[model samples]
Target: MKNNVKLARIKANLTQQQLADGVGITRQTISLIEKGKYNPSLKLCLQICYRVNAQLDEIFWISEEEFNSEENN
Candidate 1:
């Protein structure tokens, strides 16, 4: 899944550590999420969305290419 987590965090004026603290995760987890290397649980996604002032779709929507790739896989 692709996400705009880093962009949202920047727009919300939050550091990775601060967002992680607010969402009860570690900074590295936030980094991983931003890098699209980690897929957060729905609960965690909600928490991050709330903290970053982004809607779920805004933060974690899958692109058409990714969706197609997943289907192929």
Candidate 2:
């Protein structure tokens, strides 16, 4: 999975800890999400999108290959 979380965070002028606090998660979790090292749940994704004023597709995206692979996996 790929996300534009870092971009959104920067655009919002929010630190990872601030974003985490607003989204009710840990700073490490926000760091992981920003780094694309972790995939957040759909609910968490929604919360993040809401806080950042981004659409779900804008934040979390499945590339063509990834979409295909996911169906098979």
Candidate 3:
């Protein structure tokens, strides 16, 4: 999955730690999400979207190919 977390956080003037704390996750988790190293659970994704004032699609996205591949996996 892809996410605009870094962009949104910067626009919101929130550090990774601040965002993580607000969403009850570790800063490392936030970093991984920003870098696309980890896929957040639906609940966490919702929390992030809400806290960052972005729509779910604006924050987290899966390309058609990726979606297909994930289904295969």
Say which candidate scores most in lDDT.
Answer: 1
Encode model 3's per-residue lDDT on 2-65: one tens digit a residue: 6799999898889999999999999999999898789998999999988888898887776899
lDDT of each: 0.90, 0.87, 0.88
How many residue pairs clash in model 3? 0
Best-performing candidate as measured by TM-score: 1
- Between prediction 1 and prediction 2, the one with superior TM-score is 1
Winner by TM-score between candidate 3 and candidate 1: 1
What TM-score, over all chains together, does every model reach? 0.87, 0.83, 0.83
User: Which residue pairs in model 2 clash with each other?
Assistant: none
Cα lDDT tens digits, model 1, 36-62, are 778899999999999988899988888
lDDT value for model 1: 0.90
Worst 10 residues of 1 by lDDT: 64-73
Q: What overall lDDT, based on C-alpha atoms, would model 3 receive against the true structure?
A: 0.88
> Quick one: RMSD of model 1?
1.8
